[model samples]
Target: MELDDVDWKLLDLLQHDGRMTFTELAKRVSLSAPATTERVRRLEQAGIVTGYAAVVDPQRLGLPIEAIVRVKVRSLDTPRFRERVVALALVRDADHVTGDDCWLLRVVCRSMVELERFVEQAQRYGDTTTSLVFSSHVRNRPLTRAVVEGTAVD
Candidate 1:
């Protein structure tokens, strides 16, 4: 879809505050509420706007320990690993990527013991390397036009 300046502005505003009402969005974009709503609908139809979600802090939720696990699954275990990994509640995010590791997982646990158990279970499928996360400088940063267009200036 060809997004104009208005569409880009809408995306930025929505990303920052998904709960912002259509009327408020219309005011910010200088468009009528109906027009703004229609544009947003089109964006959704085009699959540009996937879905809205609430961001929560794992630390505040009693999940203080965060870790990244790299797993090199055995050739024959890939299918089983994929299914089991998806069922694990400790895994916050998982990515199948290239390199020495076949899968990268972001996980959170209440304690080191819990993390160890998870790692041990993962080791059943393949070799696992885990790293505890001390800090995260960036989480979910909003996307903007310049960034997407490769015209962003540092």
Candidate 2:
């Protein structure tokens, strides 16, 4: 579906706050609640809106340690190693990357001992180099209408 300015605005608002009520969204886009709801449904059907989720704090969840793990896998066992890592619950996100490493994993652990054990298990499949994350400066920035239009807006 071709997205108009209103559709883009709706998407921008939803990206910032997925739980925003249909009435609130309608007010922002100057459309009726039903119209806004239909637009959101169309966005979902078009695969423009994939999913919604709540961002949880790892520290609050008792997982205080966060680390980035770069893994170097043997070419022959890459597929098998990938399946293994994907099944691991501690791995929040994993990416297939270039360079000396084949994959990068973002993981959360409870403590240094827990991280060490996770590393040991991960090393069975590939060589891993891990670095602790101090903080995230920016995250989950919303895409504005200007961004989609290839124009500039603050």
Candidate 3:
């Protein structure tokens, strides 16, 4: 689905506030509620809007610990090596990168005990280290005036 100005505007609004009601989205995009709903529906169908999620504070959830684990897998070409690493729920994100380590996993758990268990399960063929994350600064998607004006974010 080719996105026009309306679609981009909807995305911009939703990016900032995914909880916005369809009626509110309609007003923001200068479209009728039904039209806005249709556009959003199409966007969802086309996979542009994957899904909505509530961004909760890990501290509030009792899972205050956050860390990035560098996993050095012994079996790089093994069939289930990647699969085994990704199966755990604590692993919020995973990526394969070039370097000494084969992959990296971002995990959040309530305590060191939980983290140790998670690590033991995740490290199917690698050594792991759990670092304490004092803080994190995650940048939100830049869907502001710059994107609207098509100046950057290219």
> How do all models score by TM-score?
0.96, 0.90, 0.79
lDDT of 2 by residue, 68-89 (tens): 9988888888777777775689
* Candidate with the larger lDDT of 1 and 3: 1
Decide which is better by TM-score, 1 or 2: 1
Residue 17 miss distance in model 1 (angstroms): 0.6
- Cα lDDT, model 3, residue 140: 52
Q: Model 3 segments beyond 4 Å from truth?
A: 76-78, 121-124, 139-154
In candidate 1, position 123 carries an lDDT of: 97
Which of the predicted structures, 1 or 2, would earn the higher lDDT when compared with the native? Answer: 1
Residue lDDT tens for model 1, 1-154: 8999999999999999999999999999999999999999999999999999999999999999999999999989988998887469989999998999999999999999999999998999999999999999988889989898888886
TM-score of 1: 0.96
- The candidate maximizing lDDT is 1
Candidate order by lDDT, highest to lowest? Answer: 1, 2, 3
Q: Model 2, residue 92: displacement in angstroms?
A: 0.5
Model 1 misplaced regions, further than 4 Å: none
Clash-forming residue pairs, model 1: none
Q: In candidate 3, what are the lDDT values of residues 1-154, reduced to their tens digit?
A: 6778888889888888899999999988889999999999998999988888878777898988888888777774444766666767788878877788777888889989988887787666777766767887764563554665788767
Which wins on TM-score, candidate 1 or candidate 3?
A: 1
Which residue pairs does candidate 3 place in steric collision?
A: none
